[model samples]
Target: MAKLGIPAAPPRGRRIQETITQLRQRILAGEWPVGSRIPTEPQLVEALGVGRNTVREAVRALAHAGVLECRQGSGTYVISTDELAPVVARRLTDDRMAEVIEVRRAFEVEAARLAARRRTPADLAALDDALAAREAAWRGGRVAEFVEADAALHTAVVAAAHNGMLAELYASIGAAMRRTVTQAMGGALTPDRHVDHARLVAAIRAGDPDLAAREAAAFLEPDPGA
Candidate 1:
């Protein structure tokens, strides 16, 4: 028998999952931008029309997944837009630098080849700008800035590939890739030993897939002796 004017509650597990989905949708919709504090418990409960426990569990789940951060007395904040990025960051440990290099080489080579085939005039312009900025940054003798510029140059190459999925995958591991570059530099950006991207950009410009791929692979090959 049901009480008058009362609705039966959904199963707790289902309620929690539903709440999580609602929260994620709001996030992906950009209602709650990254670095902005999400609604408090009472607000979430009221807005989501769910129980407090359900909201708590959903928040906990996202926090564990690295999509949300909680600071005492501050509140929960969005740390990342992509859920998988944090997972990749956690897995790409310091000792796996070799594996990181290998992965990067594979990604860069394929991206170069695809960019050669698909790049438009706008893509070439972007690549030129990115390469110029990278060179200037390296020549300026700042290791951190050079690393950022290098990442930007490679990202431009991937964008020229015109493959949405590849771009998304590249973005997911972007932070990890930056860390790999920083560690590989060993606290110095040597002038003579810098990885020149001129040939890679030129090959892409020339529409030579083989040359582009080779150019990409040249800098990223892992030492067999290691």
Candidate 2:
């Protein structure tokens, strides 16, 4: 267990996050029985070699997401699988397009920010390929091909961020939104969309975070008229 009062430090937050993810996976994998008390923060901190704050954050997130429950002073408990499963399943397929879009907006905004900061030559190449495919599909009036390429382009922007969590979350919901976009905005890629996509790529390549973010948001925002 963790020695008390040690300010937990993480040499690498990604490793710490991975530890936390493993812990969560273990819990969900039935390693922790329902109503079973999981290790305390101090114990987890020591075991995982991460800061107490990291463990606390992970625990709090899980609790908030309904995977775990913490009593005021007692301890954290794994919730029943049936209960937790539904919550996780719902998270995976909630079907709330508005909520999903809100989440995507937040993610894409940060992705644009990171892309401006971290994009590499290879990232630019991948983005170029995706965009080129999208443009070709759009010009050919092949709606399905356009949809696939459009999804690839949007996801390429996320990948350009170089944030693993952001990329993963974006991929998860991007898959869902791919369907939605094909259904909703699959018609004409639109002059506005073409302009916005090109501008976003240019802003990212130019390392302009604000411009890229604005373009991404504009791309996603619904036309009040449409």
Worst 10 residues of 1 by lDDT: 164-173
lDDT of each: 0.82, 0.70
Query: Tens digits of per-residue lDDT for model 2 on 45-109?
Result: 89877777778878876766566666544468665333433343347454666666667788888
Cα lDDT tens digits for candidate 1, 1-226: 3579687777899999999899889988878855346989999999999889899999999878877766554478665567665776577777787877888888889999999999999999999998999999888988878887788789889889987556656655565687888887888888656888999999999999999999999988889897
lDDT of 1 at 54: 90
* Clash-forming residue pairs, model 2: none
Error of 1 at 37 (Å): 20
Which ranges of candidate 1 are over 4 A from the true structure? 1-82
TM-score between candidate 2 and the true structure = 0.55
